[model samples]
Target: MAFAGMLNDEDVRAAVKACQVPGSFDYKLFFTRVGLSARADVQGQRVFNILDRDQSGFIEEEELKLFLQNFSLGA
Candidate 1:
């Protein structure tokens, strides 16, 4: 898989418990529960990177998934 699913639902529950009972969020895991990386987080980063096109570090709404239809590796 292209995503690093290191944090699971159990981890989220544990995190919530730790947040309320222990009063601290696992800072290293704040982004995992929300699905936001490619290799270390979720698929969002890879998707965004593909859509970024110009390497501007930002994605515009226009460059959607049109490219995925003809997707191929090593292009």
Candidate 2:
């Protein structure tokens, strides 16, 4: 399946806003809000890219701790 346009900025922002806690992310709520709860592997990769802020091909310790910030700067 095509992966392009799977998630738009508005959807992301809404998901983040709806699912974020004070200092952590609610994965189940966030994925459901983003419609990615049962998505494909490629789609999961897209999420990984978003979380991998440094583009280092991996989610480092700090990145994991600050993953919510990736979806929203003020998160």
Index of the highest-TM-score prediction: 2
lDDT of 1 by residue, 1-75 (tens): 222353344544444444453335444464454333323434556645765777788654344224321232211
Model 2 ranges with Cα > 4 A deviation:
1-4, 53-71
Worst 10 residues of 1 by lDDT: 66-75
Measured with C-alpha atoms, the lDDT of residue 38 in candidate 1 is 26
Please provide, for model 2 over 12-57, each residue's C-alpha lDDT reduced to its tens digit, 9 standing for 90 to 100: 6797777456655666777777777778988888878877879999
lDDT of 2 at 54: 97
- The estimated TM-scores of all candidates read 0.29, 0.54
Pairs of residues clashing in candidate 1:
37-41, 37-42
In model 2, the Cα lDDT at residue 25 comes to 64
**Cα distance off (Å), candidate 2, residue 5:** 0.9
Top-scoring candidate (lDDT): 2
